[model samples]
Target: MNRQQKGWQQLFLFSLLPLFLAIFGASGWLWWNWAISPAQLNAAKPQQIQIPPGTATQQIGTKLEQAGLIRSKIAWDLLARYISSQKSNGGFQAGTYELSANQPLNEIAQTIWDGKVIQVSFTIPEGWSLRQMADYFQKEKGWFSSQDFIDAASQIDRKKYPWLPADIPFLEGFLFPETYQVTKERITPQAVVQLMLERFEKTALPVYQKSQNQELNQPKFTLKQWVTLASIVEKEAVVQKERPRIAGVFVSRLLKGMKLESDPTVEYAFGIRQTPDKPLTFAQVRKPSPYNTYATPGLPPTPIAAPALESLKAVLNPESTEYLFFVARYDGTHVFSRTLPEHEAAVVKIRRERQR
Candidate 1:
């Protein structure tokens, strides 16, 4: 044990210490990287998913993880935070946005926030019948229809829709018209009707209930009656703002024991319940059917179609007018008259306008 040898031995030991530390540190780093890596980049590589509006951050993170976009949820949050911290108003907009695996957390956040969504806007006009709606849906390659729209729309168990009458032939006025998102694999005629019914229930039912609450001794009409009337108004009225007035006119006529004489009722049976393009003639009005308002004195067996909130509101609260008979004035407006003479005059005026 010479002093020089002892010094050399100590130096060797000290040199070995750094090597051991390096090996241990490297192993630990490798383990961490292997065990705690972020989302599987490969998993998300195959598809670009649209993140839906109102998706929870955790759900989005899980989706990313499942989709193999990122290695970890923490990374997503970190990225979101980094983006949020930037001098920007907000991080993202709510929509169906596309994403895929291997996409950086920063890009994901920006895309989601930027709301580069793949959404198809489905527009259902306010006055379109369920048959028309169904036909429109059938034509869209985006959606699949299992049955004819008219048949689908007409198929209803009055027991299920007790809001409907027992003798009703077709349920027409129950379908609400408005723009809808129509989610993928989630769209169906039944679903469409259910959504419309739910929306209608939200807005129309309250009014019907209020009306029910007011009367005693008078045979209470179920919500179905109101829906039927609303459907009539929706089809009969040329304009939205005129829906309630149209409903009021029907109500007035009904109270007076008069036939609805509604063209839609004629259309529903003889003219065009399923077909949008059909001419209505006096012969069709004279044809006998439960849906023919010209033939049947009371409400048809069921709602003719789904009605919007405006029509529903009109049914629940009608305008105070002496008029009952109404005809299209050929100017997208209607001519209303109380008596037969007035109605005849209005009809002549409409005919003249049509000829012009």
Candidate 2:
């Protein structure tokens, strides 16, 4: 070859070497960014991102990049484009999604394409009253209104539901406590109440029937009475093991024709607003109301709160015992007693512990 041609060839080779190196480095960077997570290695919680409807892929990439969920918008955008080209309807759906920082870019893209919107769950804790439940819905962000829930609950005919008693005055005891899935723009106050009632029937009816068989030799009570006693036990028992024992005490009291004198019943009479979490005053306990077990005989007209399945089962099949009294100790537990003197002694011990 001529000298001029050789010189030109060497120049070309040097230029192409730099170009090849640049291409190789860029490819390596892209591969690493796509496979490794951008989230901090020590991040304990996944960040939640809301992808609104009609959001384009470019916007999604930008959002993910800004949220530290993706290492590169360019890489994510390219992957999303590739996905779109490959599959029909390969786009992110509008809903809440939980994204961990350290997830692979390909995994995230696949998740988005899957359109699996995160299902949010809300739990109605055991022993929560209707008013408390209503307040919770109202207070929670994007939840149904409290007044709307209360109105819906009131209007629901408990008897119409096959699971509940036909003669019960209201639906207080039938809104079973449970974790409910809340979907976007789907659940309403009325819908939630209905769901809870349905769940209650599905869960409690079989237990009630079983109780009927077990207590055939004992005094038979209606479903309403069983629910009422369960509600009382729900509020009274903090320890899971003590629920049946507490129910037994209440049952024994009812059989002997003695006053229940339950503090939760008194609180229910005062309504949720006036009820105090601290110990009730003498005046509050003595106040006259239909719900006040201290003033009225037999079970209260209706349940004071939503009882858990455990509480319902406890009432239906209470431990057979002669115990008739209980007092709260300084701790979360309670001391049960068979006699007035024993109960009085427990009360004194609790008071002494409080003083100390």
Candidate 3:
């Protein structure tokens, strides 16, 4: 071959050699880390991994490896350094980091830079017991057990809660229903229950003050007594529009020295797992428990469940009426009555409809 041609060929070969080497090296490195490396950890979507504040670069890499974000801490650090990237050292941040192995390295780094965290929210329904609320977290959020929540609440004496049930154990209806914003980390069943209880107090305490004002006029109602009655009304009226009327019914029943034959009392007594649409049998209704209205005349020891704002308002501003009986129609509204004859007629209608 001519000298000029040979020179040109050599230059072309040298240039191609560097290009091939770079491609092969990068491919080898990617394979070795992503697939050829030791056992890797997988990240589920929406799973948050925490990165503590002010974490060093080495520590960040170590955490990423530990969290299964990358195969090796050294490998990630080396790559970060190799790319002439400004975010050298750890190149990632700390403080509850959420990343996935499936995400590209650049994206994962950006996630760290963005300081993403997982937030969980709990919406406690009206009249839910502390135990039930705890179970909700365990089942829904994988937080903890109902028993653990009960144990924590049990440490706080209900007796200290002046507006709570006199013969009760721990917090129950006092946990108000509301939407809560909670962090995934440092979140326990106890914390959520405590927050609900705090909210309940905020709502109930003002009503207690009004009851005190009534006592000033006639000296009959006490704060604790008022809350006890309010809780009964809270569970009885499933419909917001009928809450005040239902509260009036309960008040009328109390004043007339009649039995507060509330089925929610029995249903609540059954607890979170066993509530049913059907009413208790005569034998079941006659069960010997302080909670059984058929057997005992007074208010149940504690509220059946957490009360909503409207239910609380029903107790506070009860409609002035003579309603003494109420029955659920099961369409979320109720059948209310005043006289015994009216109540029986309503009951008969309900029973016939139920049979159908």
Candidate 4:
């Protein structure tokens, strides 16, 4: 070949090389911008999207893009691929997620991948005493001290809760029994108490007002007193259907000036329980204390436990009956009687069956 022709060919190749390099560099910059930049460049508000269970990573990217939470589906797909390559089992989780438009593609991918869901749950069972509720959190969750919870619940500002009674003696009957949720990291003893109290205010206030309008409360006793009675009934009634009946028996005894004779009140007054599910001793029953119904003429000064909705309603509208006494049967139910002789006979029958 001629020298002039070879020189021209070399110049042409060199010129093409710079053009290819410039094109490659521009492409690299664009890719980098897509990878690191927020999906919605000017988006300042947050958005919510639910990534359903078993959703593939590609679908998640598509959903995010469609929801305006992510900029590019290709970028998100690549980011998820990179994350999956780094971990043994890495993928988005199934949950309702709060994502912001300003969140970068990589950050969004990492959040769904880690499954940093935000809820912490705790349950207070029906008929759990304040102490029992405290003990439950301490023993099961290991979250806080029992006494701390008690103090926090009692000392919260009553003014903040207009529905809560001003003269409410303690937080015993007011901490409603229900499942509560809070931010996982923000779950504290005080937070739990506040949550429970708020739940009580929201749920119990209407019931309290209804009972008052119906004159369901005992004639001489105030709302708090009725609540106290309901608390006692709560601990005594093992079966759900028996709450109103048990409340009736107590009401009858109270009207006739008879001692309540409730074993749970004695246990609460003396703070003696061999086991959570055991019967009380004769000596424990006879112990003299203000809280002990056998020693006191009226309801205890304060509620002994957290009464559920059923217990509260039972006190407001007790079953009308002539029964004045009751004894526990083998099936964790009570056998009611109108007279001492009938009660004794029922007790004997229960004892014989238990012995058998």
Q: What is the C-alpha RMSD of each candidate to the true structure, in Å?
A: 10.1, 7.2, 7.7, 12.4
Worst 10 residues of 2 by lDDT: 271-280
Each candidate's number of clashing pairs is: 25, 1, 13, 1
Question: Model 1, range 1-356, lDDT digits (tens) per residue?
Answer: 99999999999999899899999999865443331224443353335665666777767777767666666677666556667788458646655555655454566666777666655557777766666677678786436563655565566755565565565555566555677665443466666666665565566666777877785433355666777777778777767777767877888888889998888878777546523233476787899998898998988877776677777767666887888877775556777777899989887776666566
The total number of steric clashes, by the backbone 3 Å criterion, in model 2 comes to 1
Query: Which stretches in model 3 have alpha-carbon errors above 4 Å?
Result: 1-47, 52-95, 99-116, 157-167, 210-223, 270-277
Give me the runs in candidate 4 sitting further than 4 Å from their true place: 1-117, 162-169, 215-221, 274-278
lDDT (Cα, tens digit) per residue for candidate 4, span 39-81? 3556667666777788988998889878877667888877788
- lDDT over C-alpha atoms for residue 24 of model 4: 99
- Per-residue CA lDDT of candidate 3, range 2-52, in tens? 999999999999989989999999997575465112332443453467777
Tell me model 3's lDDT, rounded to 2 decimals. Answer: 0.68
**Overall lDDT per candidate, in order of appearance:** 0.68, 0.81, 0.68, 0.80
TM-score of each: 0.64, 0.66, 0.66, 0.68
Q: How close is candidate 4 to the true structure, as a TM-score?
A: 0.68
| lDDT tens per residue, model 2, 102-206 | 777887888888876677777899999988888898897458788888888887564576656666655788888999886553478877888888787778877
- TM-score attained by model 3: 0.66
